[model samples]
Target: MDLMQWYQKAMSSDAYLEYMKENKERTASILEKFSIPEEDRELLERIGEHSLKVIAITEDWCGDAMVNIPILLKLAEAANIEVKMILRDENLELMDQYLTNGTSRSIPIFIFIDEEGKERMVWGPRAPLVKKVVDDENAKLPPRDHEDFPLRKKEMIQRLGNLYSTDRTIWQEVYDSLKTSLVQSILM
Candidate 1:
């Protein structure tokens, strides 16, 4: 199905609306704090001039989704750009068309399309490296039988902290570049 159909189906779910309502206050706070540079802000304000569409794939249960989706919504509102939100699982066909490397399915994948429904730019989580980091951390945990599993949870926390700090830098770069590209593309 097309993006609009997927969005309509996903939003029709009572559970999804409940989740959004429950998180509304927190989501609003997150959007309020999201900072974009003055130049980027001005560029984004012109996003709809060339007719661009943004389809955001996300799930309420996802931490990154909760954070990023709100920011995207805020940006779209400010730019007067239309946006459609779809639940990742419920929109597998749409998501599959843009899946990173044809396998990994990550939330908050922003698909940017021009007026003709041709993809202009796609941005979201990186591939293999992300899976590797998550897998490696999972491997470090002792089996369910280990008596000291609880104590070793600290090691897991530290590992995740290190992974996140490194990953955050990479993600930030991608996000900034994507924002600049999207703005420039729309203005052109």
Candidate 2:
């Protein structure tokens, strides 16, 4: 099927918003707290003129999705871009094409497309800075075979979740990364 067909079959932004209301409290929280920075507002407006759309391959349960999707939604709103959400597990056909490291089936991949449904850029899973922060945290974990590993891992996930929810610096990093990519793809 063509890209438009895929987009037509996917969940609309309204439908995705309704779907999130059921169990995506974290995502909802992030949306409530996040906003496009004033300096970035004009950039989004400029992007809006292109009439772009994005397909977000994701699921509600992913912590990365919980953090990143809201930012995308906000940008989409300001930029007047449309978004269709395709559940990764249900749409492995598309998800497989954008795997993290060509191996992991990571959620929250954003595929930006123009009005003609031509792919412009792909972004996802985590920003470079975000990945570094996550990797550094993971590096401190004990070996899997160690007795403290399980507890440490669990605690680490909890801490990251907490940080993702409350830290505006991380949110700004996410915005900066996406802005850079969008500028390269649409402006420069």
Candidate 3:
């Protein structure tokens, strides 16, 4: 299928907002709480000048999406860009094309496309800092073969979600990483 055509078939931010309202409390909380910094106004304008549209491959239940989507919506609003959401599980044809590490079907992949539908850039899942935080937590867990590993892994994920909900610093990391990547892509 044509990528642009598929993007047109994706759900609008308004519909996704309704989906979040019905599906995930954490994502709704993040959306309500996150805000773009004042310093980003100029950069946001610059991004807007490009007239890009983004398709977010995501699911409400995803922890990474809990952190990333809210920030992205804030940015999209500030920059006057349009964004659409496509559920990853339901859109594997597109999700598979943007797989993380060419393996994992990571959600929250932002595919920024120009007016002609040519992909300008992609960003997603987690920033380096966020990944580091997750990795550090994983390192503290028991070996995968251990009997307690499953429980510990689930608890660790919960802890991370809690952290994402309350930690403004992690939000900033996501904002900064997204800004850097987007700015770089615009430059290119």
Each candidate structure's TM-score, on Cα atoms with residue i matched to residue i, is 0.64, 0.93, 0.95
lDDT per residue for candidate 2 within 82-135, as digits (tens), equals 999888999889888899999999878999988888888899889889899999
- Judged by lDDT, which candidate is best? 3
Candidate 3: residue 49 Cα off by (Å): 0.8
lDDT of 1 at 30: 58
- TM-score winner between 1 and 2, please give it: 2
Global local distance difference test of model 1: 0.61
**Against the true structure, whose TM-score is highest?**
3
lDDT of each: 0.61, 0.87, 0.89
Task: Please provide, for model 1 over 1-188, each residue's C-alpha lDDT reduced to its tens digit, 9 standing for 90 to 100.
Answer: 65445444544323443557534554555555555556666667777566666777777655445455655665666666567767788777787887767887877688776666667777665333444655687788898679978778767755554443334443344446556667666655
lDDT of 3 by residue, 122-144 (tens): 99889999999998999999999
Off by over 4 Å in 1: 3-18, 21-26, 126-175, 184-188
